[model samples]
Target chain A: MTVPDPRFSLNQWTTRHWPIPDLVSGCVARGVRGVGLWREPVAEYGLARTAKLMGDEGLTVTSLCRGGFFQEKDAIAENRRAIEEAAELGTPVLVLVSGGLPEGSRDIDAARARVAECLAELAPYAGSHNVQLAIEPLHPMYASDRCVVSTLGQALDLAAPHPPEQVGVVIDTYHLWWDTAAYDDIARAGAEDRLAVFQVADWVTPLPEGVLTGRGMLGDGCVELRRFREAVEATGYTGPIEVEIFNEELWAMPGPDALTLTLDRFAEHVV
Target chain B: MTVPDPRFSLNQWTTRHWPIPDLVSGCVARGVRGVGLWREPVAEYGLARTAKLMGDEGLTVTSLCRGGFFQEKDAIAENRRAIEEAAELGTPVLVLVSGGLPEGSRDIDAARARVAECLAELAPYAGSHNVQLAIEPLHPMYASDRCVVSTLGQALDLAAPHPPEQVGVVIDTYHLWWDTAAYDDIARAGAEDRLAVFQVADWVTPLPEGVLTGRGMLGDGCVELRRFREAVEATGYTGPIEVEIFNEELWAMPGPDALTLTLDRFAEHVV
Candidate 1:
């Protein structure tokens, strides 16, 4: 039997229903050497305990799921805590989903400005913790209520004001596939050494109401997933390739079943 | 009683159920000087009759909704018929929704290439009719199932190889507001004289299933409608500003009432 690629990381969200301890064992059983974790589950499981559990299982925490939401109140403090969490977890990267426009606010420019301000404050704290802030530009559909940073180019621009070691950008196929400039931006990200994390998901259509939780399982939709992995690899990013999907049906399955299906898809479509 | 701006053209789809004659008379009564039309309604009313009615009502046809589903089997022949219809209606702009990937296809790059080929075939026919082929890039969310052309930059790039008089791009705020490069692309469109038509519609979240028909009435969402208008005008584009909305609630209302509400919203938030 072929061993799973060591670079393959199952983002905790892919098996969102899986408890931390089970997730660790499941990854080990399936030969998934790394994982991209979310803060909520880690805190719920006790961050230190979760860290020890992963260490015991020889599982590397690839990156923390998120830390931005700058439009929220006390964003800097919140992100600082996130950086500390990444440090404690021994993850080298923290994903940032920069929040959207403030409620009832039409000025996206102002909201984007606030993100920069929050990042400026948190970058130093993140650097001290040795955690690189990875700006993940959510698809443009989420620009209003999720993240105003809607393009990989914009994410790279946001990270420009910070040290490359302290700040970087994420390359997610589901979000960036539709962008015509994605290839050029990917090259730019690589050349600048800002390609921190790589993610894969396909783009399925007739997006459900709210358009969240409708992400496609790899190979079940239209995204060119392997191409994105190759692009990031071209950038010398010999790091984790996280399968981050947010499908409702995927969550309804038993955690082990879901991970099994995801690993199969990841091997077939992504790696 | 404030006068309606002469540049405000009520697009037929904004009041989708309104008959052609009723739409023309309603615009005339409201002091609206222009009307943007769709091909289906024009055909249903008889193209000659619709044209004569608009002429009798002194309502200019600002543009014809579309002429480009390039992925369809009969796309070229069908687009030729559309160009003929636009010429018959005396409209100078033929909006092109270049269509999505061929069914079950994942190669967006190839789909985009097909759009260019179709444009090359249609540009001269459209030019002969004195109708500009205006490529309208729908928001990226529609990239998979609606239009592969998902950005103003890509639209402009597609239009670049053609004569400015023959091929141009549409600036629709509803489809473009989330883009960070929108302003720059708008300026580029104007500089190249490829700014053929300007459209407005607010974007409301909780996108309905299918993610279409969820467009907001102006001022009812987060888009900066006036800013988009100003950006287009800044490009020396003095053409009619088409109010093109596709909301189920707006479509369900009485045509005259919807038109009245649209005029009010336009004056308050978009002028």
Candidate 2:
């Protein structure tokens, strides 16, 4: 049983190779339901202008791509700014890829502690603005210099200590398909009513650039997407299953073609 | 206190570019204690000649490089040959990288079932030959297509259905450091008296080919080598630590230089 597409959201970066109006008109013309954008694209288009543009196209801003990077000392002010922006755009969830191990810090536990403390402080400000903070666990290969929340279990452990409803976790397959704990974590999150988003991507070989460039488009690698969707759905998470792939190749392709391909594959495999 | 050098065993392939006798002589001249020659080397040198050469050099075959690939239809015959090879080398532990999912099969759980069942059949043969089988939990990236056992916990679980003393697991850093479950699994294995083998290697970025040729020489990456050594040592299994890296760049270097580099790094980071 395939789930119907939410049909509109265009992650701005997905269309970064294209212009904002092009992406909006493309989505609106094709009956896509909403848009998920980032700070830079919104800034480039001017936030209010972007908001007005989305409003004019009847597109909902599902999420804003960022806000955390809590491991850095200067992260505080920047994160505060992100919260303000999310409030401005009225993004329901502000996705946060917590920064990796601080330079010269060998202690991962301490890094986790740092992120948790930072999030606790940031969460209240976000809650006040009704902007939910979602922690995204990047892959473990990124443990040293990227997100320290490398597993769903670790993310949940960090999240459980915070207020239940104000903060949650984002399930991005590219960052997590390798995790052995994923199935359990997805169910656990849904049971807790905190599965903010479920994202899909594949795991291709010859990992490019080592960080973000290697994210495979859906069905391009070995991930069992339907099983992941089943795991999430079994927990009653009926919300949008976000297709948020960070693929250099796909981005280079025409935006509409990529969206069409993603939607087509999403329907066939992930739902 | 650091343990004395436990005879450097030449993992046959480490010096595949050289003949078995010459590789052993080179290792012995450099103060290496042993050589873990493979079946191909033994076949070329003649098993008796290989054994005599190592015997003449006062080297110990700590463990054979491998034995398992047991998921095949012809597994019993293949495993029996592996037993004979281990017996010939007088190697105590036959390292087994429990291979990845079988082609035409999508159920990883079922693939794991095949491993356990095959191991049960192979265990009797190994026991008869007094050959200990060591399961290696390869890195999770290799989980889908290389080893179904991707964590020490899963390896332990597979081992659980067998005798702890006969069936053990190799904690190879190159295959396992990224695993968050390593510390806990090592501790648990130590408690269970099943800490089989400890292999060390560094993880260089942009993992070469995503298959082979990317393993860093020890001390080249951010792996907490000493921390892992301490964790494994706490398990009371202070066996020889093997430095195993399959790097094309290192391979291009003279074998003796590579050996020296590996040994020096082992002393500084792992001893």
TM-score per candidate, in order? 0.98, 0.92
Per-candidate interface DockQ score: 0.89, 0.37
Off-target runs (Cα >4 Å) in candidate 1 are none
**Shift of residue B263 alpha carbon in model 1, Å:** 0.4
The 10-residue segment of model 1 chain B with minimum total lDDT is B21-30
Top candidate, metric TM-score: 1
Residue-wise C-alpha lDDT for candidate 1, range A1-271, written one tens digit per residue: 4678888899999889899888888888888899999999999999899989989999999999789999989888898899999999999999999999898999999999988888898899999999999999999999999999999999999999999999999999999999988988999999999999999888897788999988999999999898888887887888888899999999999988998888888889988
TM-score of chain B of 1: 0.99
Classified by CAPRI criteria, candidate 1 counts as high
Model 1 lDDT at residue B152: 96
Cα error, residue B48 of model 1, in Å, equals: 1.1
Model 2's DockQ?
A: 0.37
Candidate number with greatest lDDT = 1
Give, for candidate 2 chain B, the lowest lDDT window spanning 10 residues: B1-10
**lDDT tens digits, residues B1-271, model 2?**
3333773345656545766766787777777886665676677779888777778888888788677665567877877887788888787888887776666454666777888988898887888888888998887666666777877888888888778667888888877665666799889989877777787877666654465667777787767788988898888876777767787887777777777777777788776
lDDT of each: 0.92, 0.76
Q: A104 in model 2: Cα distance from truth in Å?
A: 4.9
After aligning candidate 1 to the native by TM-score, how far in Å is the CA of A30 from where it should be? 1.4
